[model samples]
Target: MKKNLFVFLLFSCFLTHSQTIRKYSNEFMNIGVDAAAMGMSNAAVANTNDVNACYWNPAGLIGLEDSQAALMHASYFANIAQYDYVAFAKPIDDESAWGMSLIRFGVDDILNTTQLIDANGTIDYNRISKFSTADYGMTFSYARKLKLPGFQYGVNTKVIRRIIGNFASSWGFGFDVGFQFEKNDWHFGLMLRDITTTYNVWNINEDEFNSIKGAVAGQNQDLPQSTEITLPKAQLGLSKKFEFHNETSLLASGNLNMQFSKTNDIFATDVVSIDPALGFEYGYTDLVFLRAGVGNFQTVTQIDNSKKIGFQPNIGLGFKYRGIQVDYALTDLGNQSAALYSNIFSLKVDLSIFR
Candidate 1:
């Protein structure tokens, strides 16, 4: 029971005591939003279709053609941490569509050294104080268009909020499902994020957790019951598009994602594990874009033990007019930072172009 503050967002979480499942729960919603799908590295689950697909593959939000809105922001490490996103989508007459999204990852002020020691251990540096640690996600989406022709489907409903300022807080719920299919031109997708497992329910502040209790020594500090579990994951995608006569075009995508247990990826085993990704985009007449991607394929273990095969690469740029769209990403999430602006940018709007 020694977490009385000064946690720097606990390196973005992943600490629990019981309540099963979990493997990276929530993970900032897998850190992919716009920026042309993290410059493609996320492989867009069959190449997304706008308004950030409510967070990728909400059946591509039926590929939105009109009402839409989006925004994004990013920063990490050097800036301490902050990420934000927003979205909106619409279309309901021709088969269906709807969307909403919001996300925020944070770390602010920090430093709350548990009253800096006192009651006989005197060291009070003015009893430092100031804190924040946040994570929030809200989503709602729906999509339809399936009478079997080119198929489509989508769903999501998620709400999670976490905080660590007063010492602890949590609330969660989740669901996701998606599917897409296209024929000749080729594209296929599927996603299943929390499918049904997510749960968080935590609340602790026992007097701010008794200011770190015994601070260790007898080592029996109890008072943990975090209860967080999130499991169920999958993604499979494929994409294709190529044309090269007058305006040029190219699109290629791939993904395997998945998670169930064993992992060092590279297709590991034990139950399920796979991680593969690739993405690309290049267009011209549709109004300029270029992108690239590669994905995380960890397997490191060096120093002389040898075993390498790490990956993650991305690049992106996009622009469109008449309906306005802008995107950019140099990519880095999990690897944390490369500094300088911390990259990633996004914006999309086509709210009927203001009617």
Candidate 2:
């Protein structure tokens, strides 16, 4: 019992310290959606020109040749988490388009360890409860080409909701704006996420606090809290396509992401966070694709009193026939073990097929 108590104290301390590095709520909105984007290290903002563009850069939606729909699913953290995404886009005319997208991320069958006790005055393993936590978002977007010909701009209005079983929940609203310029074989894109600094209002009622107070007796407890602000973020992308032979081309893309807001979480002392990623896709006659990327760089303290940047790699394969596209991607989780990776699959349908 003493050993267990000691371990619990240590874990509590770690949690307190880790908050410094963590950011505000609805982080799932930042996770990349489609397999092609993840397979390419999320560097497709400038190069995305399909239905999925609504999730990346809405400006890219103007490039969709027809009404399109895309669906994506992935298992993260060894299947402990599930992510699903869907998007639809329809070009209104020659120079304008509108779209909508839905995103869902969840963890199911989580053991509610706080209620593990039984009335017999002893721990009852079977008495432990299970619950699921889910995050969801819906976005509507509009994009139009500029009179400048190669330049385009877009905006997205987002509604976000998060739920933790029947205990607590939050509602948030935000907006995104993006610009894209495409000429010849080169593309440039910029996106401002949560441009208005999304605000999430959490409602933690008395009943919710009472439900867990018994298990959290001491250890620096605080009253139920409400409200958190998500800071704005920026992303810049540049991509170029090099055509070699009969419709075969190689596309190289790079992205730079930065956070401008400060977090109460103390994980890092820096006022801003910057991450860069690079990706490449080789397309064969626009039928098959081979993709790879490297990014997720972070400085880590080494055992030898040295600091080094860590890199995570990703690879993906894709096939497109007629109006149907299938894509698969595997992202390295930096664990070195092959089994410890993110698996993603995506399917896209071009509604023009019906025409």
Candidate 3:
């Protein structure tokens, strides 16, 4: 009990410290969807299966008996449509596995805009513009079971691209390394993602920064507009499974994730926060499951200072039949009602090629 309390306190401190480094950017690009099933459960990380291990904890592949593949898609915010993921994993002999994954988020039908000028030498109202934001990544991963007692490891490399209308675009690369340990039904996992200082090289084509005619004489000089933006994330989690009966089990887990970056842009300052979460899953005969979870950062990290803590909550449900699974999740961002509610739904088919 004392050890558990100590771990909890340590995790809390880490969350507190994480806030100082929070920033927001092309956040949609970095969002990860390991499996539709897990999405319904609020993106829990510590408890995962072989198919999703590639994204959440590669060490999970060590427990699989054969090769498997999965695909998932989500509709975000109802307006920013089209988010999807696909992944596959196959064993290397008996102690290792190799995997591949892809993620994409895109939007369409944005109103294009252009600047307008009046005859009086003054700028008129800006024209309504349509634009799009899209980002995608491809990842290669490998995981191996260690001969040492209770240890497993995995690593992943990803190439990323971000497109913002016709005026700007960027590309970058990042990596993730992870470790997991299991003894009996208890599990521990850690993942350090975007560990390398990754940056996107932006090529800007518009003269949006041009100074006005009356601007300071020396300040009007055109400046170099190209820049790079960086992203970094770290996560640690633990879980334990409890057997309630011959055909039923319950899983409870906790997670802490921290992100660091000099700026939200390839070059600007951003907000930071430490998000803590708790989740549970109940299963019967390994065929059907139900799950729910809640998570929130400290009140100081919230975007709106007027809101109180304990407002955001997440819920999800999933079902499986033979090799097919379907999942759905809903997230509530308290008091931020103007923003569309966050929801995700996914369907996956798992194929076992060898057995």
Candidate 4:
């Protein structure tokens, strides 16, 4: 029985699937971060003239005007979960730059109900256990201009870690590559995420599993531990900038994101899914900004010639001054019972000011 319980606990992590067809792992990495990027519907792959370029497109790292530092935080589902990010970038020379960033996503205060009863078989709420789940990643990036003018390329190597309470943990490694081109008022970008196929191997502590087994005796099952892999994805973006006479400008951007993994899961009438996103931004002399975006367009076809679509929208505002920038955004989660919205805030500073 104890052995069975251990097995069940080991395999339970794979059961948290959102849809019937589970083709991918590490879904949390898909949740967009950074207020400016999320406010722009995560379509900033080509609009990388900011610090968050490290996340959207490492190739954009060379686009930074000077040394910069940024921080972002978000409360998901009204504080049920949280996401945070920090980044720093410095130009290596006239045509190259280096950057580093850290991201953390987590859910806390989860009650452990496996040990609900005491040895006497009496219901004891005091014996209930609680734990937290955390996901972390550290990314190192480098960007340099290509021999062809107006063209730049970059790469990012990242280390990933996941923790579920204290029972199970996993470590992973992956790489990303990207390119950007800019000329006149037109910008284009392409990114290949997990180009090397991120892999995570989970380690289940025997002592912890034994403790859980003892708590739930006679209810154990055998389970096997294994490694998980995340397939590669591609993203393409385009943007145009329009300048006005009053130091005001408008930027329009759009992205085509696709997953090319070999999977049997059908979405929107196909085995592969192509998601599109659109966004608009208005800026006044790089001081104040307003942005709006729409994304998550999915269509489900019913048997009787009917269809349903999922579309989520978002909005954001921000201000920038000498060496300082702040941004805020509101994201719609689309019909989730726990919460319907999320709030994100970001702050950035130019470290060059101190140098």
Better of 3 and 4 by lDDT: 4
Over 1-355, each residue of candidate 3 has an lDDT whose tens digit, in order, gives 3323422432232232222223443366455574333333334456665777777877777766666777777676665678888888878877788888888887766543233334464655464345666777878888888888888888888787766566456676777788888888778888887677455555544454231211223432443344444456767788898887689988788877666533211222245445666777778887777776655443423465464444345566678887767777665534332224466766655566225
Q: What TM-score goes with each of the models?
A: 0.35, 0.87, 0.75, 0.87
Off by over 4 Å in 2: 1-24, 118-127, 261-272, 333-340
- Model 1: per-residue lDDT, tens digit, 1-355? 1233343224234254223456876677887778887888888888688778888888888888778889988887777888989999888767889899999988889776656776798877788778778888999999898899998889999999988788678888988999989999999999999888889788777776555555433542556667878888899999998999988899999899989899787788899999898988898997889988888776777799988777777788898998988988887544522223358888998988788
The TM-score that candidate 4 achieves is 0.87
For each candidate, the alpha-carbon lDDT, in order, equals 0.80, 0.80, 0.62, 0.79
| By TM-score: ranked, best first | 4, 2, 3, 1
The reply for model 1, stretches above 4 Å from the true place, is 1-31, 38-46, 49-54, 58-74, 82-109, 117-122, 125-147, 155-166, 176-202, 209-242, 250-341, 344-355
Q: Where does the lowest 10-residue lDDT sum fall in candidate 1? A: 1-10
On TM-score, who's better, 1 or 3? 3
Q: How many steric overlaps does candidate 1 have?
A: 0
lDDT of 2 by residue, 222-274 (tens): 54346666778889999998989688888999998777644222223367667
Which portions of model 4 miss their true places by more than 4 Å?
A: 1-14, 17-22, 123-126, 210-220, 261-271, 301-306, 333-340
Query: Distance from true position, residue 78, model 4, in Å?
Result: 2.8
What is the Cα-based lDDT of residue 95 in candidate 4?
Answer: 91
Clashes of 3: 12
